[model samples]
Target chain A: MPRATSRATLFEVAAQADVSVSTVSKVLNGRAGVSDETRARIEALLQDHRYQQRSGKRQAAPLLDVLCYEVDSPFGSEVLASIEQSARLQRIGMVLSGATEQATPYAHWVDDVLRRQPVGVVLIACKLSADDRQRLRSRNIPLVMVDPAGTPAPDVPSIGSADWNGGYQATRHLIDLGHTRIGIITGPADMMASTARLSGYRAALDSAGLTGEPELVRPGRFHHADGLEQGRALLSLPDPPTAIFASSDLYALGVYEAARTLGLSIPADLSVVGYDDLSIARWAGPPLTTVHVPLVAMAEQAVHLVMRLNDEPEMAFSRIDIDTTLVVRGSTAARNISK
Target chain B: MPRATSRATLFEVAAQADVSVSTVSKVLNGRAGVSDETRARIEALLQDHRYQQRSGKRQAAPLLDVLCYEVDSPFGSEVLASIEQSARLQRIGMVLSGATEQATPYAHWVDDVLRRQPVGVVLIACKLSADDRQRLRSRNIPLVMVDPAGTPAPDVPSIGSADWNGGYQATRHLIDLGHTRIGIITGPADMMASTARLSGYRAALDSAGLTGEPELVRPGRFHHADGLEQGRALLSLPDPPTAIFASSDLYALGVYEAARTLGLSIPADLSVVGYDDLSIARWAGPPLTTVHVPLVAMAEQAVHLVMRLNDEPEMAFSRIDIDTTLVVRGSTAARNISK
Candidate 1:
């Protein structure tokens, strides 16, 4: 088995061989049907790289399940990219399904997954329903939840950041930049991450002996439009916040939309803070100073956790909370001392 | 069958009933094991909406194959979300496969897909490799290509926008904004879209009676980093362009990154335009004025086309070009007139 940190991926082998990634999977799996010439070449490359079979046993090629709530958002796409990168490194094939992507019956969906026979599954930003959990458990499919939108079931292991800390960090960053009147745009109230982040934001405010004005705290979805809607409402106040903290990068971008619409320049007029520190954060015109949750690391660890659970069911159900940090970028500024 | 533009969605039903999307799917498909009480409630809701089955004859499902270069990028994810949305409304199933996401072999992979028995296939931003095409054909799986990255195989049905027109539109927008020395960042030199877009930019430059400088035209991948690199190069020229046109939104964001790094304010110090009018383009700090390629519509039409081909293989493979429209937003402005 390859080390978890192995950077060499199966996709590289395919690119090197001038063949499809699928061809490399066949050659690695010792599956019959590939022309001997192609198989031999792939084998040689595999041996050169010391790439061993996933295990000594003749198990089917590495296939895993990746489920997402939606596929379009930057957050979803970023996490998917990280997970896919990790899976590719292990030569693991992915069978992707979206909980809301289609209305395929749970029973039928399980039947399909059983046919594919993924070694493990990763569900992102959504909770696994009880019925589906029963079916997956019955099939002995190990699963890990990442950034689950709702709470994870008691027994399931989840890998994610401390949302409370992220919120606290985002708010503190704004406070440190000298903005006492800071507003927050949070995810839906039902989401654990959202409430936790809201708590963190409150915690930060309390620590500074400042009150979090209910009027400035707007709860919204982890989406751009929600950010926009809430941002407009927040900024339209009699005395709008000098700075705002958005719970997610997508939401932060929405806030930017509102800023543009309201003719409020970022930082110079309204310093903004965002979470997720996704690529968008770094590349935004005035790079968004935000909370950096380790999305890629969380995804990689989630995949690893699933694989481990698959091999060893004796493992304890656990929750691993990755730490969040502040990445000070260009989006926030001092309140009284404007640049 | 559901009308393509209908307001009713599976999510709505799931929301109305306050059940999981899977629950709604199970109830709708008449899959074994739905409880009597829950089924009755769901059925009542279904009847209320007059939602009919996708097909009169319930022969399993309308599963179709969706292929892409990779599933992680914004562009790929956007198109996918659109397809998935449409598939959900019509109760169609989608089996997504990415060319570089895993190392599954073409022949063996086909055997797996064949087992699932998808009605048709949608290949996006990737070629229908001859071998895979042959296998899919042998299995009688109809296929449609969308925004193929490479030169599409002749005789294959394809759907895309006129990249040339998009490029022309983007450049003309900059030109009309009084940018005489407008730079452009093209996609890979070998891609059809890249060439067409380049041609369109040239056409616009010719019409404006301003010669496009080779030094100002930079070709890069449809990625943010590429945009950043090319933008820097273009801006560093002794006679830098007053405006820059990026072929894709991701690339356009890269240009935004470079502008910030160089202390240039968008639409003020430097004007930038991008193609693909993806959601990110709108939420950008200074909303990018872009040529909107109808991504969701294209994907919906592609799914429809795939189904049509599956039903009638005798139908000639066709190329459909959706018109591109220019959305005037904040990114472009009259030159040297700071806002």
Candidate 2:
């Protein structure tokens, strides 16, 4: 039986090769300035010991670290899963640095990855500051940003779904259903999706002869509880709208709950619509009418962009916009004939 | 300006060191055959090239690859997210391999991982067979099984939630409420959780002086559509049970839908209960009365177990059972007063 050999040390290799550690590293990395004989001997020894060589230098596998901040949400979980799948297919291992967007800044996460000297990084729920982005550019580290917007970092690449189009389609669907007095529930003001969805809502109303009603529009964070509260608030208004378009499925589901609590039947009392047609949408009490965003496709695109950046550092920055569709379920009807 | 140094090559170093490729490798790895004088010369040369004498050998970071086989369920995404988070915290870079349990056998996945020589592997949705387990054990590759019930290799570690206990508690709650004619909608027969939950339901009934009714039991396969069909089937029986227990929240939600379709009211005409109180449960149409499984905690535990296995291979094998809680809502009520 060939007994497993104890792992070899760098010092032993350096001493036996009659060369300095730096010379061995340069030779292993395929860097210049070493004698041909020394490089050959090092290569032979590396092969004999089964040491992995990279860039002509013998070293272990390269590291690709990831930092996900504010990852406690369901969307964060989905994005993380997709990235993991993509990373695995690429055959690159990743290290996760802890930080949530709600609790930590991007600077702290970047510092952690820098300390580890990772070959590349994927940033989720993290927005790089101009200074941080500059520093990363200086270091020549490749980066791929997911769902970030309004950043003028011309060099960095980003991947995200087309929320603007999704929102537009969702809003337009309700309009086509002959709903003039439509209500809109949006995500936070700071988020790109929220603003884009709001824009879509406005565009839909504009396309029709209807004016946007400030009273009917409410903004909240992307959460089910937020949706519930907003739903209750909207329903309490003296002249409640004929139709409501929530920015997220969770919010729409909340509206369904609110309708139930108010003793009002869906489509009979109020028409409701939602976005992000999550897994639960199809099972929502009334089977929610919502926009279906291609989550898996977005994740795959993000990973592809990140990996592409790794090979061609100078590749032109690209943006991928996946399409969304409105899945009409039982939630919407011709503006309650009774109304 | 320091122009980016072109990567160094092995030939360049060997020629400069005036040693054969084999000699250089031996000296660098610090093998016994190399003379002390030759070793010193190699060490000096490596140092000049900026390579640190790492234990007399040059080494790089190790890679940890992960393959996520598609399981064709929404819950698979959530489980995958937990595994990714855990892997990231451990500083292990993961490579995701996508395989579905329905399409590929466990042995093929094991062979692929062995060939890649990842530091370790995390298999999702792939069920291990007796032969596959033996091969994994012989290779001595650390593996962490998620949601696994049994493994042929006793030494291999596994992690999952306490589904049997959860099921028992859920059924006992319904029995305590004086529901003697309780019905159950179970997941797929092959799933360990389904079997355990069925056993729990039977135990609850037995303890409550009620015999299990085969007519009231239905196989649902854990899908909302299936649950809907099963719900309709149960209600169509000559004499339907007063209360129904769905093995999963998604299925229970489907039951709620079925009730609506049949013009029956929940907790009045038919009391409904579900498991895995997912996020949508609370805000569900009826505020589902169901069992809550701590998904985040379970995820954290699985990751912790895998990381621990990496360091202390001999750590005594133990199962971590997470407690379940019953959240009462509008779905369950006192047995019909009219009856």
Model 1 CA lDDT for position B144: 88
Model 1 Cα shift for residue B160 (angstroms): 1.6
TM-score of chain B of 1: 0.79
Query: Lowest-scoring 10 consecutive residues by lDDT in candidate 1 chain A?
Result: A52-61
Candidate 1, pairs of clashing residues: A22-B104, A22-B105, A23-B105
**Candidate 2 global CA lDDT score:** 0.67
Residue A86, candidate 1: C-alpha displacement in angstroms: 3.8
* Model 2 residue B87 lDDT score: 55
| Chain A TM-score values, per prediction | 0.80, 0.77
Summarize candidate 2's per-residue lDDT along A47-164 as a digit string, tens digits: 4554432211211334566666544355565566666556556554445444543523433345445434555677764566665554444344577777663342556676667788
Residues B1-339, candidate 1: write the lDDT tens digits: 332212355677678888877887665433445676886676566555645333223334346667676576778888887887676566565656656532223323454454455677788877755755655554456878888766678868999988889989899988888889999998877567788899999999999999988899898878788999999999999878889998888888999889877988788889898899988887787788899999988988898898787666658767898999999888889999542
In model 2, the runs with Cα more than 4 Å from the true position are A1-74, A77-99, A103-120, A134-139, A149-154, B1-99, B103-126, B130-140, B149-153, B337-339
Model 1's lDDT to the true fold?
A: 0.75
